[model samples]
Target: VKKIISILQAARSKTLQQWKELDCSITIVANEAKDNVRYLYTLDKYFGPLAHASPVMMEHIPSLMNTVFMIYCTSPYYNTSEHMTSLFLKITNQMINTCKTYLCEG
Candidate 1:
């Protein structure tokens, strides 16, 4: 988990740097998105299963959520490919279910 956080932090830095380097016109160009789904997919792969998550992991949720939101939520939602949209829904539903189970178990 710590490694994941470290990676995410590094990615966030890189993304910010790239954003600063990009011109205002390039940001609006179509089909320039590269592996935008990777974030969503990788997140889904790991966050897909939380049934055995330790309480300690839950404690990191706030910090991790903020990092993830800054990294991913800033992207425009409309440009997502169909595949990404599907994965997004899957991940969203999976997370909702995990939250329900986690809270109900308490």
Candidate 2:
């Protein structure tokens, strides 16, 4: 679980780096991954195994939440790809469902 947290942090860092270095020209966005939407997929892969995990860590949740927001909002995934939108919702819902306590101390 600790390792997973580390990886999510790395992914979040990478996403930020890509966003910071992004180059846009109306036709396309050129960066490290070339498509920021890919971050969602990357995060989804990890979030899958944790869907049913007990005691999900709060450390990872914020990293993924922030990274997902950055990609889904500033990138082309914003209201463009319903597929990605569904995926984003799925992953976020997974987090919210699994880590409800962290959302608010209840």
Off by over 4 Å in 2: 1-37, 79-85, 96-106
lDDT of 1: 0.52
Clashing pairs in 1: none
lDDT of 1 by residue, 1-106 (tens): 3454456567776555444445344564533354455444444434623434345446555654564555455556434466445655665675667677667886
Q: What TM-score would each prediction reach against the true structure?
A: 0.33, 0.39
Q: For model 2, how does the per-residue alpha-carbon lDDT over 1-106 read when each residue is reduced to its tens digit?
A: 3454456567776454334334233235344345654555657645644565456444566777676666666665343676557866787777677766444554
lDDT of model 2 at position 74: 66
Cand. 2 Cα-lDDT? 0.57
